[model samples]
Target: MISADTTPPLTAVDKGRVTLLYHFVRLQMPAVKVSEPTFLTHLDRTFRIFIPKAPGPVSWAAYLEGLYAVDWLVCVGCLTGQNGAWEVLFNARTGRSDCLLVDALRARAVRLYPRDEERQDTAVTEFWGNLIAPDSAGTLPVLARYDGQRPLAPWLIRVFQNWHLSKLRQSGGTTALPDDEIALPMDTPRADGADRWHETFIAAAREWLGSLTDDERLLLGLRWRYRLSQREAAKLFDLNEGTLTRRTDKLRDRALEHIGGKLVAEGWAGDDLEGFVLTELGSLLTDDPRLSADHLGRLLAARGKSLPAG
Candidate 1:
């Protein structure tokens, strides 16, 4: 359950909020022709499809809204761009202090272009053969021509590092995605700006749902909440797809039993726990609005605290 003091939900992609994105992209990717509608679509797809599904109807709109409210919109833009190279560099800096960027670049370059002497590393093998082969659009050979011992240009890599670090220092926390995951299509068109705003809240809900202990809740988060492919979810949880299927089925049954038992214990014979959970999350956001944003930050921060060190 969330505390009562949280602020109302507001999103960056809300009706009039995307003028900033339009202005920013107008300057950064001048050749790419990013518009309000197109940026909104990208933001929506990112919020709706990018997060785990346990939290019900989580929305990035609120999170992004706060980000923009605090003038962290530039970091958000960097993450959502066509190539989030600087974003990836920013994320890599969190755990490292001394020479983090340089070390990460060296590690990334080594993994990207391994020597014949170090062929045993799987990350290296996969980087060239699997990762680049597909995303290159047949221009990988051209890229490799200049990348012998060094895959990326030294100066370009430095620029990416500098840009990412500057944003991190300015914002105080991270908001970017990795570089490899950004795959904006060349000819994407205009979208309804509202779509992005709606999805942000939904993503936040999914994040909350992921925190629950019930496997049914987890399954619900995975299938309907997060909209993740079962295979993808299985990989994330370190289980096989078949195992996930079985576990989810069992979870559904057990959840019903547990809910029914609790309802009976509470003097309500037929009350539904699943429905209660769903309705509670939905109503919490819709009724209060402010809870959506405040709860989301608390939920995310709490989860971050519980994660173990690698």
Candidate 2:
């Protein structure tokens, strides 16, 4: 079960920071056209939604309050015909605004140019598709960091431009590998009995992969296929790295448990089940294709399974 933080609720210092932010916004946004009550309502809503959910180490409530202040400043600038003023305020308030801006832009591009659904190599496409979609909770953190610096839409476009450049660098002028070339290794059994076992294992693995939701598959692909470090993967997905790591570990554990149950149902049991699954099934079930058939056969042989005649 997930453990909840036992930290106390927002403190006096937090409230003080928020109060200061409230006053700052009220002072700076005098011409924003929003009534004080309406402005306060929006600020309260922002705090309610983001305070508990903010990424931490620092005071998330205070950070959000500051963002609230900046957002109002930007709104006032936009409202008063002060072009580009929002960007200046946002950049000045948050030094890391460029990074968030880049992420937002890439997210938008993914939505604008969705790939063909029938394509086999759609992992990268799916990654971005999920990132920018409306249902993605990952976007909340990004939104909380938005200080109204520049219009949101233009900032997102700039992010897309950066993403496009990065993608070009990653491609390195090479075409993608064919599907068959990237197929998972299959064990060719020397005996009919071994062939049956091999087929059974493959079927189980495919079924397990199929059982995962699109988001789960995307996470796995990012970590395994793209070989991204947890930090890089988390940033791309708009998650805290620690949260991403924990979720990835949980997914792996769940997959292993399910696979173990399948093996037990097939009359395999004992401590060796986990070792076999991790060593044999684990290698075969990866997104990487470099694990040779010969290597796979050796692994199966170690498990006391002889191959069937082709």
Candidate 3:
């Protein structure tokens, strides 16, 4: 038995394993030169972090290899300096790994998050933005636990989906409603109250529109702002005319649904709420020459209303 004061020597197998890991990391990050002693220290620390969390005996190695293969080390290096994995490993001692890793993952998150054409009727651009915002530190920790068993993009998508679901559950689900189901009471506010209500309604409408994806915004701008025919707009976007028509109809319905929810929450339900949303949206569109009053008129007409003349 070894004395308590004496350290055990590394076995041949252990030494070989260290040599393999050193060469693997060096090959992956040729630009980052690290002394053997520094590398050995980082390797020990990395294993301590990785080993208990690994799924199998071989998983830790697989994860390290996969990270290198995907150039994640290079990305971390670029984020800190051009020094590659050495910078990352050095900074890891200072607890900067999460920040560097999250920064590296952000571009992939943006690319993988569900967007306009992917989902049937929701705009997720703002959802992605909110997930990556500085206030979302709770979400960033998930990156450290990524085992590299799957490609990073798909893994990140799954994480985002779960985060979105949790957010929705916490917020009591989505605020949007079906168009036909949105009926507001017809009571009109007095002249002085009308101005205040109109201002409030306009603010809500702007907020809802701002939440839409860029593609959704562009589609609205093309159809309403530019007054393009369905066929003309379809050709511009290289989409089939029927597809564009359906997409535009869904967009309008989504807008109505979002605005309707806000009104109901504010205790302003009934025909007055419907009227307020439509009238204010129309008025807002009228301010921009690019947005056609006739287009707003047509949308209002579908809901059994007409645009108020200037």
Instruction: Please give each candidate's TM-score.
Output: 0.28, 0.31, 0.31
CA lDDT for candidate 1:
0.40
Ranked candidates, highest TM-score first:
3, 2, 1
Please give, for residues 60-102, the per-residue lDDT of candidate 3 as tens digits: 3333432332333333333334555535433331111223323
Best by TM-score: 3
In candidate 3, which residue ranges exceed 4 Å CA deviation? 1-192, 286-310
Task: Give per-residue CA lDDT, model 1, range 1-310, as digits (tens).
Answer: 2222222344544545556545754665343444567565545443433233213444445434323221122223433353453344334332123344344444543433346335324433433242223434655321222211111233224333343345445878332332431111011232565344234434444454344564344345445423567786676556899999887777555544554444445454334545644443432233222322223333434444221122
Name the 10 consecutive residues with the lowest summed lDDT in model 2.
177-186
- How many residue pairs clash in each candidate at the backbone level? 27, 11, 8
Q: Candidate 1's error at 38, in angstroms?
A: 3.3
* Candidate 3: worst-modelled 10 consecutive residues by lDDT: 177-186
Give the alpha carbon lDDT tens digit for every residue of 93-180 in model 2. Answer: 2112433433333333433334533332243344334332432555632334333323343433434344444564586622222111
The top-ranked prediction according to lDDT is 3
